[model samples]
Target: MENLKHKARKPLALSTIFLRYFMLLCGGMLLWLGLLIGTYLIATATGEILPANYVEKQIAAAKDILVSSPEIRPDQIPSLSDYALYTQEGQYVSGSLNREQAQKAWKAVASGSKGGIRGYYTVIQREQQQEVLLLSYSIVMNYRSEWLRTHLPNPELLGIILIVTGLLLQIALWSYLFGKKLAKKMKGLQSVIGKIQNQDLEFTVQSSGVHEIDTVLDSLDTMKNELKASLRQQWEEQQARREQISALAHDIKTPLTIIRGNAELLSETAQDEIQRDYNRYILTSSAQIERYARELIEISKTQEGLKLERVTIDTASLLEDIEELLRAAAVEKEIQVHMNAHNMPDFIAIDKDLFQRAILNVVMNAVEHTPIQGNITLTAEGKSDSVCFTVDDSGGGFTFADLREATKQFYMGDRSRSSGNHHGMGLYITQSIMLRHGGQLVLGNDEVLGGAKVTLEFPLS
Candidate 1:
């Protein structure tokens, strides 16, 4: 790509495209005019077109005959083409010329002009005659060229129409070719935009040959590379962070277990109420530390990856297993755990361990938030195409920020996991599990409980 960019031609201005179109149009018109004039000249040179003064010359050859035969009438003079007779004073006497032509011709004759509107006329007069003879013929061909079939009309006007039509066609063809090329390049540019928007950066960049379009494409190619590098770097950094957390969590569990074992031994020997209270605090704090370390490992595992081992199990059996875990988590806090399942399917296909773990995580999050001895409710219901499990806690409901962002990775609320700093992966992990199961996790406030409600929608297979 770097080499290609260097090889790319400098971009031409947009005005250049318009200029080319303008030149083609003007050039076509000039060509049309030249072709029309050239055709006429060729026809004239070959005598296919008559001379302008054809009738006038014929009239001159007949003048001596009319002068010698002085008794001939005004219309009987010899001529090869149309002519008109006029009184010496310029009043019409008539032959083939119409009133309009006779009037224009008389002016030409009187002024000694060789031509009238579209034809040439020559006047012949006798010394003793009462009328003047005007011979005239059209210079603009009133008939087709001699080489054309007699059935055809005059070539002059028809040639103009045909040439103009051809000019328009030529110009249209040029415009279409140019427009097609432009559209192809634009489509290439559009493809680049689409791929970048979708973050698909693994394809070759197609060159458009055009200097301007290729320049823009080259820049976009560079941008795509930069974005890919940034994304990969972020991914690598995230993987390292998760590995570090997982290692640290694993390291902590060994020492935590020793501390808990030592606390249990101290508890067995306590004799006074004050000494008993001190021993109870050590055991309880140790247990809490152990749970936090376990959570840290769970968080890293969730981010790294989890494989689903789906198995079919009865709904009642699944619920029974979850009940044991939930009550065990809440028993020490004196929190009341109410659970029920209604309208449930006979069985469901799911990864039993992961599914139960996700449910436990949600309950635990609620347990951490609820005041000691507070109430928590779990309900499961069968839908037309899904099984929904809802957990509602009678603790302060989700704040606005939590409602919007609680499921995002590592989004600890202002009050959430207050004792477990940097430990807010429970809901995120649950959501990830739900997604992997082709399901959804919905979070909202429970109006009845006046606390946070989490609904897990599991699509049934």
Candidate 2:
């Protein structure tokens, strides 16, 4: 916020830089036009206008002729044929004009020295000289004005064309330079944002050499550092928790094994049916407790993510293994467990052990929820970019509320639907495994099976 205030108080260099370039363009265009006009004038003066010494040469020739013919009168000078030659006093001794109007023409020509159609006059002194011949020439129209009128088109169209051309050139030049510069800087910033979005904080943020952009980059770098620290702390804490859970599960495993063994022995040796029933209950309960402990340890061990050792396994072989693993539990419950998969990949790259665990948990959850003689269908197939596994059981489908929270850790279902010692981490751990393998777990009601359906999708390598 303080930086924003400082920025507000400071001059905006971006606009200033653009405006400076624009001014330069305007000034440069004006100078170019001026130069073109100056060049045109010089060209016309040299190529179209009379020479500077034209009057001098004409006066010299006239004087020579007059000196050679002494009988020639001044009025009959015969030198001024189509031109008006005169003295400084405005007296004419030339042809093509009357004496009455010589003064007016002379005055007009003398007043317009640097403009109009008139040329300079020459004064020559003779050997027996009493008077001098003041000689000059004039054109029908002023060369400068004629040249401008001949070359220039409509004023309005000229202005419009010049303005449009300048704007187009400015746009082109600005795009080539300024636009490219901004895009390059912005693209670098975008890349940094993308990396941060991907949770990759291992890169450095480079300065853009622009003050405002550099400030933003500095803020992003600081945010990246803070996020990295926070994520590291979380990972460390989670690792510690996982290790503690694993140690606890290990410590309890031996006691649980001994208790289950003792109960089984009691059940076999007891004579009374009530006593045997009690022993059987203890045995089953101890076994369930041990299974829960093992599952807890396994889930905690891979809390962070699975370290997959991927291999190409045949789909048929994998399905067969799953069916065999769950066959005992399904038969005990009198549930019909069927495998229906076709149009699947021959081989898939997967961590066979982790994949098996995920499949087992999903199938076991279905088995626990399904009633006796219920149907459980497991399907696997290849999709466009992934392979999918679906487990659907013929039992009461999940409630809407359960559908939303069923995958959460330790979220057990209702008492009637939940299995003994089951705390609802099965789907959670399954989801974790699927995510670790770059897949997702989706839960819903199966239309065909009319029960809860769990779909696991894995991306193809």
Candidate 3:
């Protein structure tokens, strides 16, 4: 049972909950409306019957008086001054009758003397022993007033019904509008979440014209953006670490190879002078280790973020400097290093030191990859928006995968074919420097030289 309960899923949305509550409220309002109308009808019916019962009570009281005083003369009866007075013509009269006139009128009616006509009459009689007057009276009941009471609702009850109905309608309308706005906001948020799930972290939720919903959406958007930024930073850091490890391995391999070769030579020999040779071999290995450490430190400092000192660097002079630096290495390999320029601009905006390092790295890479007697050509050309430096070699070209991963740190195509000093950090650092200068590095197969081509394109400004 616990497992099953755990497996039970949460509701997909809160909309259903809101809908349930809204429906309940609407139902309650409808019930109230019904009750209001029912109460109005009941009150109207009771209101109509109240006046008739009051008139019946008054008639009964008059009959009691007549029965108690049978000796009263026709002109000496008790007056109904508290009741509404009317004339014989059924119009409102000026004044009410006195007790004597009331008694006279009642006695005349009991003695069968017709005085004035009335409508809807009821009579109560009493017996007497002596020759006495039997008092009677007529009342003209207003049937129009009674009919109105029977058919029409009381004003207060009607007003209550209108107020309640109006309130219910307002509640329903407001709920409908709020629900629509809520649904729209929810849909927008759902779309944003869907995009986020698909790893598209660039979208934002649109406002839904509701303050609370918009505020929530804004907060979610901010959180998603922060998460995306953090993840991207972590990924970049991981990539950097992997590259560092690969570069470290590459840097250590050369000394290890030389050490192993010298050890093998010493093992085959059986002379006392072999110790001196082994000592020299160990010293050489130590030197290589020192060089590797220094190079690693320089690489680390560059990657840690070097502040650029901007200067206008002459492209032609920079190319000459690179040529002078690589000439010795090229002479050792018997490779020809050629530098050429056509329509080259004299100066470009750059940090002279960083730009020189970037250019020298590419040239060194070309020289290292090219075999003996191969040609390494360096060319510079200025276009409208950018200046391009191209290095073309006549060595074996890179594979498709190598070309794709060329700028990645410690991504070497063939270690044996590369120069012993090759640590695969040259191109990676070159690419990073180019990016800092608002430039790019392009790697492809050199169609003309049948070797690798590396182009560094820098913005003209």
Candidate 1 pairs with clashing backbones:
none
Candidate 1 root-mean-square deviation in Å: 7.2
Write one digit per residue (lDDT tens) for candidate 1, span 170-191.
8798789778868976897899
Output the lDDT of residue 451, model 2: 92
TM-score of each: 0.67, 0.51, 0.46
Single out the weakest 10-residue window by summed lDDT for candidate 3: 1-10
Leading candidate by lDDT: 1
Candidate 3 positional error at 259, Å: 17
**Candidate 2 at 82: error in angstroms?**
22
Model 3 per-residue lDDT at 129? 25
lDDT of 3 by residue, 165-196 (tens): 77777687767876785686578767877887
Per-candidate count of clashing residue pairs (backbone under 3 Å): 0, 0, 5
Query: Which of 1 and 2 is ahead in TM-score?
Result: 1
The window of 10 residues in a row where model 1 has the poorest summed lDDT is 1-10
Which one is best on TM-score? 1
The TM-score-based order of candidates, best leading, equals 1, 2, 3
lDDT of 3: 0.64
